[model samples]
Target: MENSPEIATDAASLRPAGVSAVALSRLASATGGQLLHVPQNADPDEIAISGVSIDSRSVRSGDLYAALPGARFHGADFTRSAREAGAAAVLTDPAGAQILGSDPGLPVVVTPDPRSQVGAIARAVYDSQPEDGSGLSLFAVTGTNGKTTTTYFTNSILRALGETTGLIGTIEILAGGQRIPSRLTTPEAPTVHALLSVMRESGMTAASMEVSSHAIAFHRVDGIRYDVAGFTNLTQDHLDLHGTMEAYFGVKAQLFTPERTQRAVIAVADDDDEWGIRMARHARAQLGAENVDVFAMRGGVVADREEDPDRRGADWTLRSMSRRGIGHRFELVHRDGRSLRVSTGLPGEFNVANAALAALMILASGVELETLQRVLDDDDPLTTDVPGRMQLIGTEPTAVVDFAHNPDALARALAAVDPPDGDGRVILVFGATGDRDRTKRPLMGEIAAREADVVIISDDDPHGEDPAAIREEVAAGARSLVEAGTARAVEVYEISPRAVAIRSAVQMAGPQDSVIVAGRGHETVQEIAGVDHPLDDRAELRAALDEMQEGRWERR
Candidate 1:
């Protein structure tokens, strides 16, 4: 967290150390942009910002604020605040350029397509060279679920193999033995290069990154070359942004492009996995520079034969797996018939899939299977905990907090749980996020109703969307299950106060019941209509569970 005071107030003040105006102009020229304010020969030493910002509040004094037109509002509206806050210059598309006025004679850079140029401009400013030259092996794991877990476990396995590792995921940044809060699952273009640069400078030999579909589509990871790429599984999620499941899957598939990665590893668990595998293979065959490696958790079935579903077994078979105090121990069976008993403190079957994906990446990176076996046995799995991912909150009533906001994720989470010891029911308290993939709201409801004995639908950052509307969607879906007789009558409740929801669920939960709180897993803040409200689901769930214990004692 060590930082210089000069750049403390304005991130713009931290212009990449050695950039020059000539270089900036060259970069501008490449993007067909015009430098409106500063002289072409202006000393680059004084240039502070590497890119532009749309939000003025986030703009540092040295930032190049961008006055772009957004669907909701014009970035130009924030130009005055940006300048007052110490913006060195402003960047805007020509349309915005005509509307925005600046005080303090702030410099303005005009381009026709400011948004398109942002990534390229940031790359030039940061001087992002290919990652291979850094002598560090960079791996990117992408999918609908398990991205964070795979990245986290990949870090662990890499560490076990004697390599210093860095990670960027939903939980936090695992860097320099410190946990830094993450602003985004995948940060913007400049920030990504900046973080990687820091990792390289720190002498890390390997780094594992969770690449979100949005990040790939937006060119956030534009400048980096991944040594290896891993896929977990794809499912229904993020439809709000991508518009359709196919489009969503297409974005995730962007990671396996041969030009972006050297080696590809795929997990064939879902129907859409074939698209990823086909794309990777096509990339290798067409590009000829990258190599493709396919992996299946299902055993003995040839890669092509597993397509039949009935014949396909897992590339790695797990058995005799017993849950022990928030962790699970199982034996991983490889295709060669050699099995390794792995005692991973990580919970859930999804985690085992994540571990298998991580292990595959390690093997793909040239780590021997024998070394991976020893690491799985001796190296503790609990050490690399992925936050909010089937994260166990308490043993009593067995409360778990997860980031499963969609039907697929919810199904996996429900399946992962050991279904209360005897007659205990799995009680789920969750709701769909507002303004996102509304279609999945009821699907999630049906999932909860069909899989869980009790369902509690609550708030999940309605963000400009009516909370009631969201709740109704979920209710409707759950109602579908009841009407269809797919499940027994579901117990549904609308609890606006999440803390109260957790408390109510805990109060009713018995020793045999499993309480699951999903959606907004590791998110510390609840975002609504672009405003963030402080609300950590994990903390709230734990606090409620602790109070429930006290209440039981008091009743005794």
Candidate 2:
């Protein structure tokens, strides 16, 4: 229950400098909330509000403190602290208003649901989208795996096109070159608007953000609309929250609506399940066919499918891909016969999908094909490094760290790293997240057993669940496949404390073998039993390789 130091100081750092204040009454009226408890001498319209914050510890003077209801406690219980921290007023639900009782000594805006209104209020207070329409050209990507990489690619491409860009995603938030550590794939609504305002004030012209399903379900991106929204792919993950894959897809589908994005770019590559195709159809229905662009890898199952004529062609088709170093160089051919040759240094054919989606999104945002092609060919924006995303750490045994936590992602990562024309084995070290999608543990295990020569089940973010239990579930799946004689003779071992498992994987790898540390990619901390332990896969892999090299040198 300790207050976060970042939250305590966020008021000064996260809030944009010289933001134009909006009248308190205007926000209440805009959100259709009842305004009450204004000071006797103050007119509601004259009470200026400079910012918005959901966390009381981050409240600053002239900020509207959004006191929402939580599962355990009502946020209005912290209103006194928010007031002491110089909050101007309170925005809360009726229950929160009741928690404050009467005469709370500040103006209160009461609504039935405050969580849904936080984004709108923050937007108006920060003027994130200026009335003059000179705001950041917002781009958002949402899906299971490639959201982070696609956004990074989008930001890089935007920069390549001579635009000052900002980024909001899993690793960090870059606002006009100022880097801030990120805690979520998409942060809370207030922080989202505040970051956008910072980008605008710092003269950034475009910003790319990763929008997670949790963000959409929780209304984190309530009011802000993107110039272009991209979907990478949907897979079996986050079932703990959404309960069903259908429901999960429903939440991702929300981002492509006309209200959330001006244009939609959907990737339908290898769409055997047809989620991508369904998403494209939904987007086109909602935003009109002109505003929706479908992208596919030319030889993918979906692109080659002859059953449905509607799924036959995409606006952009990735074709003629040839391996370039660890990654692939591919050509993005449009249905209109315009083609742009692009490449991503990041490994995996899926990254080719991510890079293609990024290019299509930029083009959908009104960037000319010639300009985009110039950036792709000349600047090679898609070749930029994305942390923890197929990030290669060593060359001798081919060590890699990736954030492929789900069954689909894990399968793809294994396929990408499998030794091509060698006796090299695929050594995988991975574990399911505690307290999330329990069903995926066995599926991931079975995949590891099937695809990898050696499987080391290690703890990811155990959270509150018992790490041993989580490992056993994954081991059960792997063991089932191995015992059933359906999979290759894979050696599966359960190793704890994660660091040891990583070292073990590295030690087992040979010069031609690949050691992949999957899950928790780009994440430096591992959360277990409400505590964070420092654990960077990249750093650990490098240290292990260094140790191996040092030992070899000594032996020689």
Candidate 3:
């Protein structure tokens, strides 16, 4: 198993150029903290903080180091290191303050809980968000899946409309002309504020971000309110951290509150899943009915519900969809009979939902319908490449690489790649991530068995679990389905050293077959136990196809 790239901890490296400083006294007052160890002759209000950082090692000159308490060691243990790194002041909780003993040789801001105030401190120091609503127009998306693609679609449309845009998501962070690979679905609160400040400093007009459930639960997105927030559907995943699906939903719902966003666009496409409908209702209750918009892609129960006026039909609908090349052409129809014709070259029906959410989110952010329509027709921004998202590598064997790590995503990917008219079979290569929701492992395997013709159970960041054991758990589900003989005939294989599995899948595939390498989409490193190994699914798949082509040339 390979480990994720370490987050860039050097605050100076990530901070925006020429950011104005903020007074330490003002920050303490804003966060309801008390200033301790202020110099006898020095005024606390005159002490300037140029930046904020939670990690001691990331501290820079004129920075306020937030010494927070963690599960194991308190951040105060590194106060000497932070001071050595040129941190001008410190912000810590009561426990951390005690850990520092007396006269820690720096100005200290003591709060009951410093972690919750990190965002506010960073925002104030960086001036990331303006009070008069004058800076970047912020947009955010959250859900089990599609958040990345939706945010990408949103940024692309913003660019098409002639606005320089920034993006913060699972894959990377884009601040106007600057690009940084991301280590987390949502980075720490300080990094979020720093990137936004950078975008603003660069004269970017708008920004889109992915709000993971973990981010909200950990207060990673605090102190910033979005112009619009969109919700993709929720499903089983992340049980290890959240403990339950309901808990996960609650964390996601936090982003829809009036304090967090000015408006919301929610996808309620599935009638069987009430999570979307419930989310819409929650947003409406929090932000008021006028601020929330319900979007339906297939006109499900949400479109027909008339029992309660509050639970009424969809505000926006995606209809009149038809196949357009490998993608689809669809109409986004408003309840008032207004509509916009849009299309996405992306490979899945779920992508249609993603594009729709993006469009509606822009509309919710006050973009005119005509403007969006013209941009859609002229630029077709929705067709832009979202890396590793149903990414096509080859046409002959229909080779694709996708970040579908869960049951819902795996099933959707399989359905999208399965041939509709030809005899080509679906060849799937996938594995469940270790140290995650173990319950989903069998579910994902069953999905692959039912949807694909050949199932290759492989390794995906095994972390600390036994790789063979993880494969067996997944293989058990496929083997059970095969033994029961309840589904179509399927061939299953358990393979290791993921690269070889890619080659084996390609070797067994015919020209008409579709080969999908799911999970760890854009991730280049595969973590085994505690070490990170160099591996990229797209590179391996491409290499295998090139080898096969070379073999044919040699035969000739």
By lDDT, the best candidate is: 3
Clashing pairs in 3: 1-526, 1-527, 1-528, 2-526, 2-527, 2-528, 2-532
Over the full model, what C-alpha lDDT does candidate 3 score relative to the true structure?
A: 0.88
Candidate 1: tens digits of C-alpha lDDT, residues 114-231: 7666666655555545424754688899888889888888887887778888777766665434456676788766566556655656666788888998888777787667888888
Q: In angstroms, how far off is 137's CA in candidate 1? A: 2.7
For residues 136-206, write the lDDT of model 2, one tens digit per residue: 99999999989999998998898888888888899888774466678888889988898899888878899
Q: Please give the lDDT score at residue 214 for candidate 3.
A: 86
Over 4 Å off, model 1: 1-22, 32-69, 74-92, 100-112, 128-132, 175-178, 270-290, 299-343, 418-422, 528-532, 552-556
The per-residue C-alpha lDDT of model 2 at residue 523 equals: 94
Candidate 1, lDDT over the whole model: 0.70
What lDDT does the true structure give each of the candidates? 0.70, 0.87, 0.88
What is the Cα-based lDDT of residue 215 in candidate 3?
Answer: 95
Q: Give me the runs in candidate 2 sitting further than 4 Å from their true place.
A: 1-12, 299-313, 552-556
Clashing pairs in 2: none
lDDT of 3 by residue, 1-556 (tens): 0012234433236788877889888988988988899889889889999988888877889999999888799999999999999988999999888988888999999999888999888888788998876689999999999999999999999988988888899998877465667788888999899989888887888999999998998889999899999999999989999998899999999999988999999998766667988898898889887888888877455455453536776888888999999899999887778988989999889999999999999989999999999999999999988888999999779999999999999999999998879579899999989888899998888888888999999999999999999999999888888999854427999988899999989998888899999998999999998999999999999999999888953311
Model 2 lowest lDDT segment of ten: 1-10
